[model samples]
Target: MRGFDTILVVDWSAAEGVRRAERDSIWIGAVRDGMAEKPRPMPTRREAETWLADRIGSEIAAGRRVMAAFDFPFGYPAGFAEAVTGASDPLRLWDWLAERIEDDARGRNNRFEVAADLNRLFPGTGPFWGKPHRDRFPDIPYHGRSRDGHGMAEKRACEVASGASSSVWQLFFNPTVGSQALMGLPMLSRLRRIEGLAVWPFEPVDDAPAVLAEIWPGLIEQAVRGREGIRDMQQVARLAWAFSRLSTAELTDMMDVDAPEEGWILGAGHGPRLTELAMTAPDPMADPPPAARAPLEPPPLSNDCFALPPGVHWTPVDEALDLLRARLSPVAGRETVPAVGADGRILAADAVARRANPPGANSAVDGYGFAHEATGAGPQHLPLIAGRAAAGAPLAGAVPRGQAVRILTGALIPEGVDTVVLEEDTRTDGTAIAFNGPVKRGANTRRAGEDVDAGAVLLPAGHALRPADLALLAATGVAEVEVFRRLRVGVLSTGDELGAPGVDPDPAVTYDANRPMLLALAARWGHEPVDLGHCADDRDALRAVLDGAGTDVIVTSGGASAGDEDHVSALLGETGSLAAWRIALKPGRPLALGIWKGRPVFGVPGNPVAAFTCALIFARPALSLLAGGGWRAPLAMTVPAGFAKRKKAGRREFLRARLRDGRAEVFASEGSGRISGLAWAEGFVELPDGPAEIAPGDPVRFLPYAGFGL
Candidate 1:
């Protein structure tokens, strides 16, 4: 009723297995206030569920009412639910499907078999139809037309009103949404159980944290039919934008429905409203909403922002990440810098293309340019024009009939000339040129906006600029960008026995590796490294360094545990802000997370290897948010295991590993004292917090060192 603080539109995929970021995969587009996040392509329903669930929880925690729509009917034909589940309530159908339908990340399911079982229970030919094969499905029909006497309405009342052509009975083929519903309903059932989450039409949604709804993107076909890129992506983006722009009263009317048995689409009877709203969707190329440019300084962390969730003995990787994403707000300040100087800086707002690349139609080769039609059915010859079009120059006038002009790459094609022939393909004399017949039309001609369209969004907010990205920004005529200031990270290492890198240590002591390594890691992540310097394990001394740190956040090694001499953590605990997550990760512990003087402090373990691993795996993402860049999850790939191991649940392990024969080989020793192992391995093989008896061919997640940037 409040028009939702956030709107997410999903185009669910019905693919049987994990898919890539391509067509036929799930795509989600979202709008918050007046800004839109880049569409996300999900490879599996499992991932989509996790992402959707987490986002809902995160939004609710932030006190934002969310409207999440999936492109599938929420209910079947009116009587179908009663006939199948013996209940008129649409939720009953969702529960029944949740219990009967089985789906997995690998894209295998028993939907067809489940449908076959349902058909045998119903009278006559039954309602469900369509599958991947031509082979007969004794109970399920190949086509909806082949079925009869199902004793159920072919389409729901809302479907007919909304002009949604594909009925729930058509499981596949002809732009059908049935399979998506069958696959998505189980996830919906899981979501319905979330606290403060409600289903539209079927459940009253007053002041709910989030509302789940069935949306037919085709309700406003004109809005998405002509957009570029993937159709599914465009549909969700424009639709979400349109929905987010609606007024409270308008949204109320759309939601004022009573189709408990046949759940209504959000905008089923408001087609004109949808069309009208689509006409005014925000332009991508234009400057985003002012809110998109976050304030130069971020607000302080909310109460209990760093407090760990209770009832968890060991924090898992996913829980840690979700907590970071939900609670940690960016603390970095903002600035506008020249595009060239914006290297490695996270965008404070989206950077749009000021102009298209290859601003005009130009020649792509140094050859003859003329009307493609001039090349008749046979080998043709034409007189060379007096003028030439070279790179950075243009021909004065259109080429005359039966004439061709010499054109070099990057030169604008003259009027009336739409094609070019490579010099090697043509026999050119001093005054004329001859080429073969049947030349491809518009060949070797670079059209305007071929690489990038004018006003297109070049980079989304929070994207860190890379060297290659600068080329794109420059090509698109972006002069300067709004970026977050580099975070000032201070590193403090304790223990009088430790010495600096170049200095020799005492007989019983080793040179301090954690401090320098942590500082360098912070620098590599585009932060301003501040050396807090080493100090002995005096709580008063540590407190003094932290008080005068004057940095955005601080990182400390050693003395983080709860032992008597663990001053770093003791100081934080005294301040009532310490949360030793005691995370269940190898080489990770007492991830001393706390806020001191309004700045986050990370106190890692003493062991060099443990400090490095914990900093990379746990502190990296948290620090990213503290720096005003959004949480960044390290990229990981699945590779076969080159070694065998038996592990118990409760602890996640990250083994220093390298890729060999396309498999991940862990370091020789699992010992945390082996600091040399960190340098020996190229990446880390992460084991989940589940009992795993891994063998040689088993798959494991490999996180490359390069993926972390730092």
Candidate 2:
């Protein structure tokens, strides 16, 4: 009463008394003015029936709408059983039971007398009631029973009808008791009649507070409050709580209830509890979060920032690729030129044919050729007229009828001649020619422009020259082509301890590995690599080398760090400007970016391993940008761990590893300075910065050499 506006507690055993109690509860709780007073409960089934009849009669007399909840099962049980058994008529089974009860109670004086009397009045027909017990009811044969019964059967009819009509009544069973009862016998049979009601097998109840807390706090609270004013309120409250708890998704699923929408408000209060319920409700229609967003910043240019010691750079590999794509996008233009044999390069513009292939009609092979009339229909020997028609020669004269003329391969076919007899198929007889076989019309003739027309387009713009393209262009008389300018990249190694290969080694110095590596790398990308030689640990010397490099990009190694002998950073600071330094990464953290003499300069760390890793990670993207090409790193794969280690988060780390037993195993010495570790490594394992340590059995992402721009 304190919580709900109206509450109805159904009690079918004492229908009249329960109805009165429900009416009183509703009357006491009503606050609205001019509301009709709730009626008292009828004390017995007879009284309840009389009250219903009287209420309906009064409603009809007054012309008013009357609504009420009943305690009968209605047709629900039969409907339920019909659905389960796929039967056409489940009520027949109920009638069969009624008949059996009546036959057993015919003379017996007991409570079953009512049940037995009802059965005889409703003898079942149809497949649902297997041939009614003939011997038991021998006096009343099974053949002539009515579908709805009569006389003594009419009493049984009430009970049979009660089983179905009683369905509407079970709604008030103490939730627990009602649920169990509905799961069994007569009530179950009645439930089967309700259209589209799904019922699952009942499960035993358990007192799980966590589950109760999540599912039914509202019901529990209501039941607790109901105890203050009602008899057996605690029992009802517990039953309500159990029923609410049992209303699980699995049960609702069987009931065909749609899951609640996610993020929807539930209940009337605005607090954490209400929010929790709303959040916990299953959401079959919830939409996924929007796809992860990318930065709106334009792709970084080579001269954007310089990496110095202690500065943070946040560009990811994807961003780097985007920058390269932006810088390397192609410009629109076209040009056309000669392409013959292997000389055809990519066409810069559409080319129109200047002349047709096969300049004039001619013979395709050598033979004594003439019109069919000149050779005649019958086999006859004829004079061989002397007339030459080579590739560039015209026929001397038309042959007379019954006479043949001499012609060579690729010679023009004489006018008025439609065929040529091969020399192998002819013989000389008394200075005359004789054909051994018949010649077809248009034989051995090459027509002008058979392959292409003079005004047609020979090749379109942007077509890469292939061998066949070359031949076609040559045949079409195309002579020149325009193409994109090749990109040039300047390669330089920075460090007093570094020297070029083949140079005498200084015990304290090492040969410059970055130069040769960069050269080969640049060449692979279609750029001309200019070697600027090695720069000593002098700022002026490095600048002088950079000034004269004249390359679109300047890549240097060994002087990016802030060490005492490291001069690349000082050189960049004094000569030009630094863009960014020291990205949030391990191993190859010391990186320098800046512009020198209007050219982009990247100072990679000097350690052999570090330099190579940084080149693959950073320089490759920068180079792609300079060369007018897009960049993309290969994909990473998940592999089993080969060893164990600890790592910190916030910075990305890479370790040299090898595939072993189908798993990626880390090298013994993973230090960046250990070149041998890299040499022995087949790939790299990426480690995210975190407090969690990786164990031997932990799975990790392995980046094979192919994935790292190798």
Candidate 3:
């Protein structure tokens, strides 16, 4: 067997509409080696198809062996397919159903109808039934029950063997899994047709880059019961863990199981082995394979490459940003808000100009308005008109011939008058005005629609509104604007060595500084931060809090590094999912990213300085993405290095610094635990990746704390 590189577990769904990482919707869990990568969600089956196609292509191109598992059964009971579709072979049946199933991206699916249609070929009621809420699929009966001498309710061999699993024919009762099967098998059929991918048990697994298989989460779920956190997430994690830890002999034995028509579950009869392996396995990050441990070239941007070997797991900052981009997308909900109250909100749609800036031509200054060519030469005078045009009050009648109107600043220009002469340049009498200075055409005259035109986009979507943007909105005369809702962030602090400040502390415990700092930072960014309190270095307590934290994203400050007291990473790998990112950056080195209860969670180091640095450098941009603005690199400017210092190579460093005498100055201390360094420093002086000698007057990149929304 090829060294398995990637394992993808998809908990398929028959429900309509895009859904969050909750129950009954699509949650795709993937792992490289033993580490769980980010699981992508698909609102509709069509999106899953498109995403899987691209992902499979990318994985194959990267020379990786991939195993993808879907939760639904791949085949029906032995002879029932032949009775209905006249096909004895399951692949033929797959094709027959794939061509007839109707589903769309708009949450419209004919799963019940397809089931009814297939049941029409059978004798009495059905092997599949369950009337939908609307359009009650009337061609066939809408219910199914096992009756004496009935052939339709026959159970598949696998379903009978796995006592906890649901039967394929029970579409309506007892867990209602038939809908997933009816809707899922057709998609798998389409996937099997792709080149370089093989379907398990049916297709012989050779050197194909990816192998598709059927999985029943129950087989392993029973062995790993009584665990906290989300059941579905744990099941997926266990599946990935069990599959990755399988020895070559055990994997071959699983593949060689005998199943004529019905498919065997991937981990059947190996529950004890999988559970033991999951419980007693050594740390996956302890010792990596030679390929993973080998020093390779710097990783390309994530947009250019998606997956890499586990040994060389530490991603460059640029590549990490790219991977974050791949993991996050803008939220989809939009709301109409009053322009007056929309300040500090992100625009969901483009704000267009309702009308032109100036309704008509107006005077630019307080002066006499007259036709430019009416005065032929200098020192010429014209008769003053009786009516005057002032701001907000325009003269109604047209200008008389050989006459000039007294117009004030911002007043509309009189009809047939195209120029304004300043009062300082002309002497005015009671009845006539004298012009002495050189007069030119269109002097000091404002044109209509100069500032803005109707129907033009004044501000595009994804723009964060500022005070100036509100003024622009008011000028555009737009009463209401569409904007994205603010993101809800949950802040958690972990470790038995932490407690609230000002409280009596244990002899060995310190104050909890990271949570308060994170919460304050999130609030400063105009986001809603929910306090998730604190958790000790215990998995059960952490799991309880994680299962109940309902925010859009989670930020934790501790238990991320690979230490014995680091229970967060270990628990995350067991319950939900986790990916350890050994980022090549100073101050913040160990970063953990994963999904818990369907929401994104970020785990930073325990040190206050390191936690603060990681939150600003990584979490802020991720929050921006969740707020629908997408990711933005920290704003950096080149400034002169105020102090000289020698630095090492390999990792990039962000030293606490402030501008002094027009040059950036570094703080004296470089320790990550120094909280005073953050308070005293105004910004950071960023060092490059490689070693270099910095002297006075050398240019260095400066990143202000304000740029990170501090």
The stretch of ten residues in a row with the least summed lDDT in candidate 3 is 295-304
Computed on alpha carbons, the lDDT of every model, listed in order, comes to: 0.82, 0.48, 0.74
Higher-TM-score candidate among 1 and 2?
1
Residue 608 in model 3: lDDT: 92
The residue-by-residue lDDT of candidate 2 on 190-300, one tens digit each, is 333332222221211121101100111232243344343343333222322232222234323322321211001111122233333323322212322221121212233
Best-performing candidate as measured by TM-score: 1
Error of 3 at 45 (Å): 48
Order of the predicted models by TM-score, top scorer first? 1, 3, 2
Instruction: Put down candidate 3 lDDT per residue, 408-464, tens digits, no spaces.
Output: 999999887999999888888768899874688889888776666565556645667
The residue-level lDDT of candidate 1 at 60 comes to 62
Error of 3 at 393 (Å): 1.5
By TM-score, how accurate is candidate 3? 0.56
Ranking by lDDT: 1, 3, 2
Q: What is the number of residue pairs that collide in model 2?
A: 57
Lowest-sum lDDT 10-residue window in model 2: 205-214
